[model samples]
Target: MKKVVLITGASSGLGKSIGEFLHEKGYTVYGTSRNPDKITDSVFRLLQLEVRDVESINNAVAKLLAAEGRIDVLVNNAGVGILGPLEEIPTDEIRNNFETNLFGPIEVMKAVLPQMRIQKSGLIINITSIAGYMGLPYRSVYSASKGALEYVTEALRMEVKPFGIEVTNVAPGEFATNIAAHRYHVRVSQASPYGAYAKTIEVINSQVGGGDDPALMGGAIYKIINTPKPNIHYKVGPFLSRFSIVLKRILPDKMYEKMLMNHYKL
Candidate 1:
């Protein structure tokens, strides 16, 4: 039997790359986006979905189930990044970020788990970020969102293990995706006071360079999905993530904060 995979936020970036990679590997792929028309026909089956809306998510799954009968893999890749000081960010903006980044995946998983449980097999691959493990200067809310996702992925892994469903969280450091450019929310009012700090944020963005190639992340996701027994988490991108992991393990809380402040020049 051919494996069927459903990927969210598949209009572009890592999600689209994963969809294309999986399709090339001979899996029946269903890719979902807010604007399905934007998805290329060569990639996979494009389904209209808005992760922020529970109704849209449920409806998309219903349509997929009606057509394909089963989904073997669920890739929750739809997420938005909100970059700014925690105090400066709007309450509504924070809610919106959490809705799309955290709750969206949770709802989609809830919708799919019933069928997956009945089948006694499935894989849930969540595209988290390096920010999930460590905090950055201007990305407090975004980091928090991913941190919540990391925890959710951990909990879900244990919950679904008994049902023969595997959950994997792929944390990519940086990919050459428009996510940084497209998703950043800068509040000029809040930033005006921190003139030098605002300039530092720009420098950090320039250094990150939109991340590594999206294809690298695509390959990593492909490997995880294809593995006979996937691990709980797969970290991709440059060696910097490894360094951060080591630092996280070895450094004290205050010291770690100091180190990060120095490294980013924040």
Candidate 2:
């Protein structure tokens, strides 16, 4: 029997790429999108899933379980991003960020765990960010959201290990995707002191525009799933971004912060 794979936020970007690539590899791939109409892949089944909505999540999972006897891989690629100074950002927006990026995945994991536990085999991959490794300027909330998710994945890996369930956090450094269009910019006043950093937006945008192809990410994930035993964390992206994870570990606190600032030209 073919392995069953379900990916959230599969309308486009890395999620869509992964779905399409895995489908080509002969996995039974089911993808979820907030606007089901946005999923254009003919080979992949699109399920209506608004990760922020509990009912939508439950219904989607139920439908998948009904159609497929089991889901071998669950990729939590559904996430939203916010950009701005933490102090100026709205509380509701912060909550919205966490709701989609953190809580949404947690809820989905809860819904799938029982079935996975009973089967004694499953792989859960959470798509986090390099920002999680080091909080970036003007993207504090985005970094915090991913950081928290990574921490949760750490604990979850241990908890699920005994049941033959594998949990991995795949942190992509940067990719050329529609993520720029989805990033919410916190409204900042002209009088705000932090307004000077507004130029960082363009810098970040340029970085993303030149980032690596997401097809590479799909290949990385494919290899991960096929591995007999995978590690708890994997960083997929450009060499520098992947190296940043190591640099952060060996460098002193202030030196690492300065390196990040210099990278963004802060």
Any idea how many clashes model 2 has? Answer: 0
Model 1 CA deviation exceeding 4 Å by range:
40-42
- The candidate that achieves the highest lDDT relative to the unseen native structure: 2
Backbone clash pairs in model 1 (N, Cα, C under 3 Å; residues 3+ apart or in different chains), count: 4
Q: What is the C-alpha lDDT profile of model 1 across 1-266, one tens digit per residue?
A: 78989999988888888888888889999989898875555458889899888899999999999998999999999998788767667899999999999999999999999999999999999988888888878788888899899999999899989999999898888777777667857656643665456766775677568567788877888888879899888889878865797788899989999988887676
Worst 10 residues of 1 by lDDT: 187-196
lDDT of 2 by residue, 17-112 (tens): 899899999999999998888555546999999989989988998999999979899999999878988888889999999999999999999888
lDDT accuracy of residue 175 in candidate 2: 92
How well does candidate 2 match the true structure in TM-score terms?
A: 0.97
lDDT of 2: 0.90
lDDT of 1 at 95: 92
Name the lDDT value of residue 70 in candidate 1.
Answer: 96
